[model samples]
Target: MPAERMADFRPDAAADVTDVVCPVTFVKALAALDELEDGRILEIRLNDGEAARNVPLSLKDEGHQVLRLTDNGDGTCALLVRKVSACPVE
Candidate 1:
């Protein structure tokens, strides 16, 4: 999505994992998403390079909807993700 559209998104929760490293970054982000109700959005602030590369893909693999990822221009990035409802078992 465009940056303008991304600016309009109001996340239900936010997490900053810039202080942490790779797997931990994604872990923190996942924990934040877990606290939110399904369909709610989460804004994750993480460092560039590894965290930026891995977090969003990890979220997507877990069935969340990745809305946007934008650079903050300060060696950090913001990732917007929406928690998706789990499919019911038949």
Candidate 2:
């Protein structure tokens, strides 16, 4: 429901990393995001703890736009990220 706030923008791609841990979680999401064109949206589903907290900031650091983060009420959350820059931060 909370994710509905951005109903106007649909994701270009989606990755589910709920089975993965912290670093790998972001890695998978990043990998999927890497395949997208600039300004495309990537929807990542991850666990609610560290992955949820860190992945968004990490993506932002990488020059991505973190659009929305929504709770599925099942210990998992969905992160909506727009790829603003495909280049990685050094």
Candidate 3:
């Protein structure tokens, strides 16, 4: 999404994983998203290196919509994601 649009986005929830590493970062982000109903947006605050590269892709692979990923200019980034509902098991 464009920065202008993202500026107006109001997330339903937010999570901070800047203190964690790779898999754990993604895990915490997923847990935050899991707490919300499908279609809700989540703002994830994560570090700028590996977590920045991996978490968004992981969330995309799990069928979530990545709205935006903005750098905070302080070794961290804000990832905006919208949870997508899974298909029914049946």
Candidate 4:
């Protein structure tokens, strides 16, 4: 897939959250999710196995949504996610 399509990344969109290019900090990123306003979409870059899998899973578990991901061959991948409106706004 093309990087743009796979990444599902749109830098022009409104951003409420972002993180260092780390997978382990995904939980930390989740914790900071509330800081995002409802209906906001955030883009992230992740590298390595644990994060590529965990971040998406964690977002789902928290009731947030993983809109899409670009699987870069290297450890780095791009993610597009939206915060759930139903979750309490932080």
Candidate 5:
């Protein structure tokens, strides 16, 4: 079987870019999640590349946890990160 890759996530799923149009960075994604009112299970569907790979680590660094990682098998992956707790105020 082929190894699961993060880069594949991007092309497989089209970024909505609808409600939010900020730079599609991992940090931006986190910030968006932080600003959300509802506790979210954010499914960051991106190509299995830098953004996809770094998101989990970035979340961990910020005290958030990645709850699930789903590969769509079509060049996209879903990173389901629950808003478990707050990122400690700095």
Candidate 6:
């Protein structure tokens, strides 16, 4: 899907990890994903630099769809992800 549509996309679930650091940020996002159903969309709010970089990549690596990322212009970004599998591919 187009990146702009992500802004208007209504996710099945949403999470905020802007208060946390890396690893933990992705951890929380993963945990949230764990609770979601397949084909569901997750909207995650994360810190700008590391978490922003890593979480989406990790999700993609795990076979999920990293749909879109929008910078909030405040050291944070919103990530839209679609759950493609029940568990992460390890």
**TM-score winner:** 3
lDDT of 1 by residue, 2-85 (tens): 667777888999999999998999999988988999999999999999999999999998889999999999999999999996
Decide which is better by TM-score, 5 or 6: 6
Question: lDDT by residue for model 5 over 1-90, one digit each (tens)?
Answer: 244543333321122212332235665666657655444556666666565577677776766656667677876676766565664588
Q: How are the candidates ranked when ordered by lDDT, highest leading? A: 3, 1, 2, 6, 4, 5
Provide backbone clash counts, one per model: 0, 0, 0, 2, 14, 0
Error of 4 at 17 (Å): 11
Ranking by TM-score: 3, 1, 2, 6, 4, 5
| Model 6 lDDT per residue over 1-90, tens place | 565655676799999998898788888998999899998999999988889899999989888898888899998898999988845347
TM-scores for candidates 1 onward, in order: 0.88, 0.87, 0.90, 0.63, 0.60, 0.85
lDDT of each: 0.92, 0.89, 0.92, 0.64, 0.56, 0.88
> Model 5: residues >4 Å from true position, as ranges?
1-24, 85-90
The residue ranges of model 1 lying beyond 4 angstroms of the native Cα positions read: 1-6, 87-90
Please give the distance, in angstroms, between residue 2's alpha carbon in candidate 5 and its true position after superposition: 24
Q: Which ten residues in a row are the worst by lDDT in model 6?
A: 1-10
Per-residue C-alpha lDDT of model 3 across residues 1-90, encoded as one tens digit per residue? 556777887899999998889899999998999899999999999999899999999999889999899999999999999999777666
Q: List, residue by residue over 1-90, the lDDT tens digit for candidate 2.
A: 375568777988889999999899989988998799998999999999999999999999888899988899999999999998655447
